[model samples]
Target: MFSSKIVTFNKINFLNKLSDGFKITNKSHREYFNLGHPLESPPTLRGSMVVEFKMSFILDNEEFFEYGSPVDIGGLSAGYIGLENYKASDLKVNFFDFDKIISEISAVRFYERQKFLEHEITESVYGILKSNFNNDLADFIRFDENPHSRLFEFCLAGGYKINEDHVQKIHIPNTYKNSLLMKRISDRFKGRVLTFNPKYGFESRNVG
Candidate 1:
């Protein structure tokens, strides 16, 4: 049901092409993913925005077949609705998978060490992996939150590459790293929640 192809992972070259605001078609086992416009129908993309379909094969499961690429890393799944019925974080007990919710909160975004060459552009699946928690419910909407930093970090680490945590500490761009600092100043204010929104050309405006 998806068009699959093998492509090289070039950090700057790729992101330069992927300007911003793209849709992903995979959730679990994100091995085969499609990037394209939100309005396009699947299977047959007429003027498909699908940038490319890539498979980062593993050489006998030991190393990535592609020089600096790694196997597909998974992302957080949007939980089903009717969550009020879930009582607690119990794997067998909670149908909502509450225990997994805790893991989602603490999940660390790391990558395979062997796939990268100590210092090379990697991938932004880290942010994808980090969507378990975010500034907004992007999983439900399937939107990328830290595109600016994702782009910046992609330059430093290259797409998804980073210095192994053991080798060098990660230096996140100020946009994402200090994003929470504003909340410190924000908690002081209590305002009405936005309840009305109107769709505009590409972008939306809060008409409430």
Candidate 2:
């Protein structure tokens, strides 16, 4: 039953067909990055920018008490809706390798290099190519920057570089390819993503 559907939310925008509701300053990651540092981090899962909707569904079925409780403003907007046929398997990442990289790199070098690398990457010299990929992932997790593009930009952020050749070699998993909801404007996913309404009940559109 839980596997069949997932809940998500969006900001009300003039262009949104289902855009309706009062906006609130949820302490999610989008605001975390947007608001900058020296602030208390909100206890929320998934930042606003990464998934423009609440993803408590990820923890909904856990046996632990209130695992997914106190989600922000659910059912408040027409744009606030549920996704049908959601699956965790659809989301993939080589987190094992990424976590390994995160652990292996020296803290000094990781923090110092803040610029994206421009050189071509090969399998043999992949480890030598550096631009703080680990720290960038940390920022992405803490902040709501658009995800590092797997194709064109290659780098995780400005200096965190990963080329096509090295990406395949390292087994850097494509995380968002099959996700039903990513930033719709980013062109990361094609079309046919669906949303459900809580108002009149249900309506879906191909969000391209």
Candidate 3:
């Protein structure tokens, strides 16, 4: 279940708010980030951390939607455990405008350009998508590595490394455009993994 009220926030306060972690309940489609559950749970999320927010560029662009599908441009997601799996170059945390980076990395090809936009998940679900997308394991984890289906074969007894080619194809952020913001994010989250932002605290969608 989700609250019908739309949440809002600005980049500045949002950055500050994330320093304190939070939890979201009833998240759908991000079972990977929840710490203690057996992977059998469905795509729906019981709860998840809001480590990263993928702001929807399209939300403000009605023109873009006129010609293209009105996709739920972006949403929040977790980046803790999954981030560690990425190489420094792949992570590219300090080299991008968060919005631009996610857009490019999750280009149209990965998503069904038209009908896909109709289905949207909560911030927690988006967080799961973010984690997998950033870590370059979206496909592998979703299709090939069904840890639940093959618990012994994959989860307990198997191991694999990230495919360099796959990671190479993902987008790299442009640090020049937003270095200061990137620095703040990187510094605040440095050496910290598996943490998330509070679902409701500082302010969501606050305006002065």
Best by TM-score: 3
**Cα deviation in Å at residue 114, candidate 1?**
32
* Model 2 misplaced stretches (Cα beyond 4 Å): 1-92, 106-112, 116-208
Candidate 1 lDDT over residue span 1-208, tens digit each: 1111221223323222232213232232122221111111112212111122211211111121111111111111133222223221211212123224323323433442211111122334334334433323223222333221111100011222111111111111223223342232122221311111211211111122
Q: Ranking by TM-score, best first? A: 3, 2, 1
TM-score of every candidate? 0.16, 0.18, 0.20
Model 3 scores a C-alpha lDDT of 0.26
* Per-residue lDDT of model 3, residues 63-101, tens digit only: 222111111111111322332343423422221333343
Candidate 2 weakest lDDT stretch, 10 residues: 31-40
Which lDDT tens digits does candidate 2 get at residues 1-208? Answer: 0011112244333112111122332323122001001111221222211222211222221221111100111221232323223222222223243333323332225222211111112332234223323434233222322211111110011111111111110100124323443333223222423332222122211122
Q: Residue 175 error for model 1, in Å?
A: 32
Better of 2 and 3 by lDDT: 3
**RMSD of candidate 3 to true structure, Å:** 18.5
lDDT rank, highest first? 3, 1, 2
Candidate maximizing lDDT: 3
